[model samples]
Every structure is written in C-alpha cells, then in structure tokens.
Target: MRISVIGTGYLGTTHAACMAELGFEVVGLDSDPKKIEQLASGVLPFHEPGLPELLRKHTASGRLRFTTSYAEVGAWADVHFIAVGTPQKAGDHAADMTYVDGATSALAGHITRDCLIVGKSTVPVGTARRLGNLVRESTSGDVKVDLLWNPEFLREGYAVEDTLRPDRLVAGGDSAAAIDLLKLVYAKALKSGTPFISTDLETAELVKAAANAFLATKISFINAFSEVTEHVGGDIRVLADAIGLDNRIGRRFLNAGVGFGGGCLPKDIRALQARVSELGLDRTMRFLSEVDEINLRRRDRVVHLATEILKDLQGRKIAVLGVAFKPHSDDVRDSPALDVAAQLFNAGADVSVFDPEAMENARKRFPRLNYTKSAAEALENSALTILLTEWDEFKELNPTEVGDIVESKAIIDGRNVLHVQDWLDAGWRFESLGRRSV
Candidate 1:
C-alpha cells in the first residue's frame, strides 16, 4: 500500500521511512519547508538511532519522498497517517488539538480517492469518533474515506525498533475495510507474530493515555519509596528489587532515581486528567496529580542536594551530566535533567551541561547555561558533578579519572547508576537520591 505521513517531527519522520522500508512507496509531508528540505536531503533534524540510515536508503532509492503539499499526496497515496504532535496546551493540562484538527481537515479537503485516514497522534478519548464526523462534514464526498485511531507506542531512544517490530499493534475503527487495509500495511509485522488489537475508537485512544499514566505511576511509585528511603536508613534500590522480584511486579520502570520526564509521560498523564475532568469525572483521575507532584519533587530533590553540597551557590562551578530526559535521543521537552540543570543555573551556580546528543536542543531551550563539548569538559574544575540522565557513556565513567578533574571531590548520582563505594574510595564525597551520603 502507498502511504503518506503528515508531520515530519519525531514520529512522522520515522514512520514515513519505516513504511518505505516495509516496501511501500511513501511520501512524508510537512508544512515547514526547512524540515522538508532537510529530510529530502537525507538529514534528520533530531537524534534517533538507526533512523538516519533508513531515511538515506529510502530517499536514495526513490521509495520514500518528501513534500510540503497536501494536494500532492492526496491523489497519490492509498493511506494517510496523521503523526502530528499533540503537545500540552499552554496554561492548561488539556492536549492542544490544533495540529491534529488542521491535518485531518487538510487531508479531508484534498483526498482524491477512497482511502483510510489513520490517527497516530495521541489525543483525548472520543477524538477519533469526533474527527470521523469532522472528516465526513469537511470532505467533498468525492471519494469513500475511513478513519481509524492507531496509537503509536514508540519509546524515543528505541523508536525505529519499536516501529519496524512492535510488540503489539492496536487499530480502532468500526469499518472492516479500514481494518483490512491496515492489516495489509502491517502484514510483515503480523506475520512475524506482532499481536494486532482491533477495537472501537475510544478504546484505542484510551490505550495510549492509560499506558502512559500507568508508566508514570510506576516510576513515581518507586520514587515515592525513594523519598521514604531517603529519610529513613533503607536502601531504595534494594526495596525496589525486593518488590520487583515478584513475578507480577516486573522490574521495568521501578528504578529509584530522578523520576520520569520526557515529551510523552508528563503531558500525557496531565492531559488524561484534564480530559476526564472535562467530562465531569474530576475525581476519577485525581491521583495523577500526585504522580506529577512526585515527578517534579524528584527535580527539587536534586537542586536541594546540590545547594546543600556546594554550601553556597553563587559562582560555584557545577557539572551536569546528561541534559536529555533519558538517553540515546536529543529530546528535552519536560526533561528532568534539563529542569534540574536550569534550576541550578537560576540558583546562581555556574552549571556546565553535557549530553551525548542533546546539547544542541538543550542549548536552544536554555541558552544561558554553559554547553560543554564532552562530559570531561563539563567536569573540569567543577566543585560538584551531577549525573542526571543515565546515558551509557556517563554510566561508564571511571571514578578515579573524574576525581582528578573536579576541583572539589563531590558527586551526586541523580539516576542511581554509579557504584557508591567506588566514588567514596576515590576520596570523593558522594551522594545519591535514595542513599546515605558518604
């Protein structure tokens, strides 16, 4: 099946290329001329492992192309996927549906043949049903059009692997024709044993929201335990391991460290709450407020620890490792690491930041802080060092080498990945979020 994907941001760009890899002729559309030009030139605007090679191969082979015109892809492709972003609305917890609505209307106005329009963007439940009506009303009815909500379950660092080989696939629409067409599109994955979930629109939309809320809750649950462990003399990691040992309570996101932050988790949970409240179910998702509170509190704990260690913040050279929310990708939206680094900078500390891939994006967001070329540069001559994001390079650093660089031998393990005894043996004062400092 031929496919056209809207929005060339993280999700769309990856989907477009992966569709081409699955042997479908694909066209990726974006309103931004700069982004289209970059993608068309085989340059990825963001960091995602294994995506660049796919984009280059497909574009070079003419299986994947990019354009800024909806009319072009409208008459050409049999399916159009809406992979646009649904970022949190400013001054509100609800998702801003402006982009999704605009993309749907644009395609509805221009689609020239019978096709399926898939909603890959996360949204409030019932959005698919609502958008189905909007599509029927907005379209000229020159062709038969079907709508489906196929929520993407892509993790940032592992987006490519997730897309090409998903653990499961969910498609929500009432039309059998639309479902069949989607099955054809994902036939390879289906043949490879990827579970396909067929359901109604609301359930499909809720899956994404519910999944994010649960993951956020899991991370906050462990961090909440870390808070207790921080006050009392108990090992938070050990507590997590003991509980996670249960066959039911798997050790996935139970790490006790700086809490979850990224484009997905923080906004998705808040948006889910706001959506339910709009339906007058205010108290239904009330606990998510505490989830958010716990996540934000993790950042506060880091800043407070930094202040306590430095004694005085003014003019203290502080090294911050890993400004991206997690690792392997350059996304910094609602990133816990970046938030902590920014807070430290605002608190009058000279915060030098380093991330393997996120420095460019981090610099764009917080230009006032120092962006270092390497982790070593950030550590040099610093009074204190903080490891926020758990990148492999940051986790593998030698304690003795880091000890020689920093002016004062003090380090904070924000992610709880380091060996506490090793740092202590290096003659450095070490502190972690849920551990007794030494």
Candidate 2:
C-alpha cells in the first residue's frame, strides 16, 4: 500500500515512519523546506525516543521518503493522511483550521483520480464533513475524495510504541470503501486484537477530543485532591494508590504534583470546552473549565510554597528542577514546571532552572530565566529547591549529596517523587504537595 502523510511535524513524522515500518511505501510531505531537507538526510527535528532509529531504518531502505511538494504526495498514493497541526487560535480557545484547510485543498487540486484523504489531526467535530465538501468543490468535480477521521492518540514520549501497537483504532467515514481501506491499512493491529471501531465522522472527531478531555480531567481530578490533601495533611500518593486499587478507578494519570502541562492536554481541554460552548452546550463545558483552572492553580501553588519557604522571594536564590511538561520528551508547550519557574522569577525570586532534555525549548519560552547545565548546578547555593517534573535523574538524586550543594537544605517535592523521609533524615527541610513536612 502506498500512503502519503502531509505535514511532517511530530504527529506527521512519526506516522509516516511507522507506516513505512508497517510494510507500506510512505511519502512524507511538509511545507517547510528545512524540515524536508533534515528528514531527507535522516535527521529528525524533534526528540522522540527510538524515532531516529525508526526513521533511519525506513529511509535507508527507500520505503520512506520526504518531499516538499504536495503534487508529489497527491500523485504518489491512493491514501493521504492529513496530519497538519490544528493549533489553538490566537485570542480564542478554538483550534485553528488554516493548516488543515490548506493541506486538504492542495491535496484536492493535485489528485485526478479516486483517493482517500484521512484526517489524523485532532479537530472540532463535523470538520471532516466540512472538509469533504471543500475538497469536492476544489477538485471541480474531477476527482473523488473520500474524507475519513482517524484521529491520532500518540503521546510525545511514546509515539513509536503507540503507533506500532495502538490501544485501539477509531475510523469514521461515510463511504464503506474508505472505512475498509483504513481497516486494511491497520490490519496488523486489528488481527492482533486491537479494537477497530467505525463510526460517523462527528463521533470519530469527538472521540479524540473526548479522550484528551478525560485524561486532562483525570490529572486535574488528582491535583484537585492534592489541594485538599495539603490542607488535611494527607499523603496523596498513598491515597491515590489505595483508591486506584479499586477495579473501576484506574491508576493512570493519578499522579498529583505540578499537574499536566504539555502540548496536548492543556490546549485540547480548552479547545474542547470552547467547541462545546459553540455548539450551544455552555453548561456542559463547566466541568472542563474547572479542570483547566485546577491545573493552572497547581503552578501558582508551587510558587506560593516557594515564597512562603523563603519568607521573601525577593533576592532569594531558588533552584527549579525540570522544565518539560513530562520526562523523556523535549516539548515544553504548556509545561507546569516552567510556568512555576516563570511565576517565581516574576515574583522577585532569583531562580535557576535545569531540565534533562527541555532546557533548549524552555529557553526559547523563557529567555530571561537563568538556565543551568545540571540540577546540582542549579541547586548550588540555593535557599530553596523544587522538583517540578519527576525525571529519572531527579528521582534518583541522593538526598545527602543534594543537601550539600545548597546553602539552605530546603526542597519542595512538586511531583511527590522525592523520598521525603530520606531527605528529612539527611537533615534537609522538605516541603511537598499533598503532604505535611516541616
């Protein structure tokens, strides 16, 4: 099977490479010449664990290729995956469809025969039907394009694994041909017992947004508990473990700390809320708004804790550990750790920040903040330290050794990953969310 994946960003690039690895001839198209050039040279623009190796393997075998022209993509395949970004629009929470519209229109103009155009980007419900009309109109009735929604659910750090063996596959299109083609394309997973669900276009689009909304809600739900836990002097981690033991309540996304801050969760929730309101369901979006507020408040809580610890943040040397929204990924789109660091700096703290992989991206977002090469370097002579993201390096730090680097042995366990008793035993004053430690 020949497939063309448009827009070689994180989703597009990973999708293209994985499809090629699945024994399909894949062509990746991007408007950015630099991105295309880099991919052509077997270089990936972003950091995804095991992606470089996968891209290299497929590109070297000539099963995967990158191109700058949509004409090539249109002519090269019977199936074209529209994986362009639907970023949150400025001044509004709705997703911007400019990239999606442009990619679909361009693909429509170049195709002369029947083709299946699958949307892999997260979009507002009913976008697929609208785009189908636009494609038919642009093609001047010369080509038949079947629009399908196959929203991607791959997380940044686990993109390759998610693509190769997805939890489930949701496809939606009006035509049986389009649905069957997608089924065949993902037959390996279907054969391996991965649920292959087919529905209408609207349901398929809502499935992606709803899935993200649920994950965001789960994180916020725990963070909300963290708030009450702090007041009641309760250990949220232990509480979460106890509650998660229930068969109905799963353990995933229950970590209570700085909260979720990534490219997907933060934006998708707001976008989903905004979309719901636009559809005349304003009351239904209230819970989502609270979820977003809870997530944002966690950042403020971290900053407030730092201020309280130092008595006065003004002229206080504080170290912030971790900037990425999560570990093992360099993306810092809405990172909670970086958000707290920025708030602290604004509140007059002399903050030094460090992260294993997100420093470069964080630097771009917060150029005014001081960035250190190592966590210990960031903690050097610090009055207070905060572990914002639970990276393995941060988790495995020796309490005694870390205590020696700082002038004041005070630390905030933002993610609750640190051993509070161990730090306390090492003569360090440890403060953490959802727990009592003096």
Count of clashing residue pairs in every prediction = 0, 0
Residue 366, candidate 2: C-alpha displacement in angstroms:
1.2
| TM-score of model 1 vs. true structure | 0.99
Local error of candidate 2 at 424, Å?
0.8
Candidate 1 whole-model C-alpha lDDT, 0 to 1: 0.94
Worst 10 residues of 2 by lDDT: 136-145
List per-prediction Cα lDDT, in the order shown. Answer: 0.94, 0.90
lDDT winner: 1
Models 1 onward score TM values of 0.99, 0.98
List candidate 1 stretches off by more than 4 Å.
Answer: none
Report residue 40 deviation for candidate 1 (angstroms): 0.2
When summed lDDT is taken over every stretch of 10 residues in candidate 1, the lowest stretch is: 135-144
201-307 per-residue lDDT for model 1 (tens digits): 99999999999999999999999988888898688899888899997999889998888888889999999999999999989999999999998999999999998
lDDT of 2 at 367: 98
Candidate 2 structure quality by residue, lDDT tens digits, 142-201 = 667788999999989999999999999999889998899999899899899999899999
